[model samples]
Target: MRLTHFRHSCVLVEMSDTRVLFDPGTFSQGFEGLTGLDAIVVTHQHPDHIDPVRIGALVDANPDAQLFADPTTAAARGDRWIAAVPGHDYGIGNLIARAVGGVHAVIHPDMPTIDNTSILLGDEERIGRFYHPGDALFVPDVPVDVLGLPVNAPWCRISETIDFFRAVSPTVAVPIHDELLSPEGAAIYLARLTDMRPDGADLLRWEAEATQEF
Candidate 1:
């Protein structure tokens, strides 16, 4: 599998002859003009997770790509958007995307939690699995090969971030959902996360917009 981080939470995963992009939000870049994608998966409806302004253009460009998002976002994002319900699987090329989490993390007590489905991509033969948890910390039952870790967020703290990384224990964990942090702040967070990551798990930070094989 190949992974490309496009700033913030947006990432492009190429595996099993399929190209799938996750969370082309307001903070992400370089995904607007992508074509020939097998699927576009959105974990939640937050503006940072799904840019309402530029998403139409992206969808228009990849007309053949399947659109998948949480139920509410799917219902509102035209008829083509499919809801990623928990326990359900969506086929994308040679991989199967299984939806796990059904709710987003709470930003605050007063704010209502929304739908957030963590998508796990794996082939039928069980070769490898790539997990994108979006904005939630929900862990899947199966082992993960690569993890898109949300290192910083409004609803997340450094301790929770460390715990999540440890719990997942993926072979590789890459930081995501980090648009709010400055370079220095990101360095601090990354250092801590790297230091506390589980044994045998590598914390990798791929260069933005560049693809690297995993």
Candidate 2:
């Protein structure tokens, strides 16, 4: 599979002549005017994960693209947006997309937690399994090949992130949800994750707008 990192949590996955885009949010770029998308997935209602200002145009451009989002976001968006319920499977071209993680991480005691639907995509044989957990540290029971790891977030600490990484134990770890970090700051997080990574596991540095094979 080939994966392209746009910005922050946005990623484009292409495999078996199918293209799927995830999290076209406010912090993301280079996703505008994209065509031939098989599906567009949003993990939550937050503007950082799904931009209200630009999503309409994106949908307009890809009218045939299947829209998937968290229950709250799907209900509010329209009929075209299907709710990504946990344990349910949706076919996307040659792959199956399954939703997991029902709730977002707790920001604080006073703030209400929202829905976060982390997705797992794989083929029929379950090869090339890729997991993308939007704003949550959801560890799947199944084995994963590639993991989109959120390196920084307000609700989580570095220790928590490390633990989640160890739990998932993917073959490859790709950092996402890192719009808040500077180059040096991101390097710090990456270094720690690399040091604490599972034995023989690889951590990748994906360049924006460039597709890297996993």
Candidate 3:
């Protein structure tokens, strides 16, 4: 699979001639050039994670592309797209996705109402997973190959980020929701992870302009 990181939480996953775009948001770029999108996976309804207008444009461009999002997010759009329920699995083309529930933050315990989700992709064996935790901080029970975590997630401290990595134990960890910091800040965070936990995980500091294969 090929992964391209745009600004903020947006990521483009290419597999088997199908492109799956996750968390299409306002800060994201390069959507204009995307083709053959099998589906769009949205984790929540936050402005940074889900831009309704931009998503509408994407749907307009790719009429055949299905949308998989949380119930609230899907209701907000009020369109004929598929709604992704927590703990349910759905398939689109070669991608199979399962939603894992998580908390957005510790402060507002019940306001968000399970808006965050961790999506699991791939088949039963030799699965390649992509997790977008949104603004959540908990690790699910499932295994993950590539974990997309919010590095400096709003309302959570740096310690929360560290604890999340330790729990998830993914092979490759990519930092997301970090538009407020510089590229060097992301590097420093990864470096600290190396020193703190040598056996922890590999941090994939995604550059907006670069493309990566997993």
Q: How far is candidate 3 from the true structure (C-alpha RMSD, Å)?
A: 2.1
Candidate 3 positional error at 27, Å: 2.0
C-alpha lDDT (0 to 100) for residue 30 of candidate 1: 93
Candidate 2 lDDT at 109 equals 88
Candidate with the larger lDDT of 2 and 3: 2
Worst 10 residues of 3 by lDDT: 102-111
Per-prediction backbone clash count: 0, 0, 0
In candidate 1, what are the lDDT values of residues 99-165, reduced to their tens digit? 9989898889999988999999998765238999998999888899999999899999999989999
Per-residue lDDT of 50-160 in model 3, one digit per residue for the tens? 875677778878888888877777887777666787678787787777777744565565554556666777665634477777767757787778888777755767777
Query: lDDT of each prediction vs. the true structure?
Result: 0.90, 0.91, 0.74
Q: Is candidate 1 or candidate 3 better by lDDT?
A: 1
Residue pairs with colliding backbones in model 3 are: none
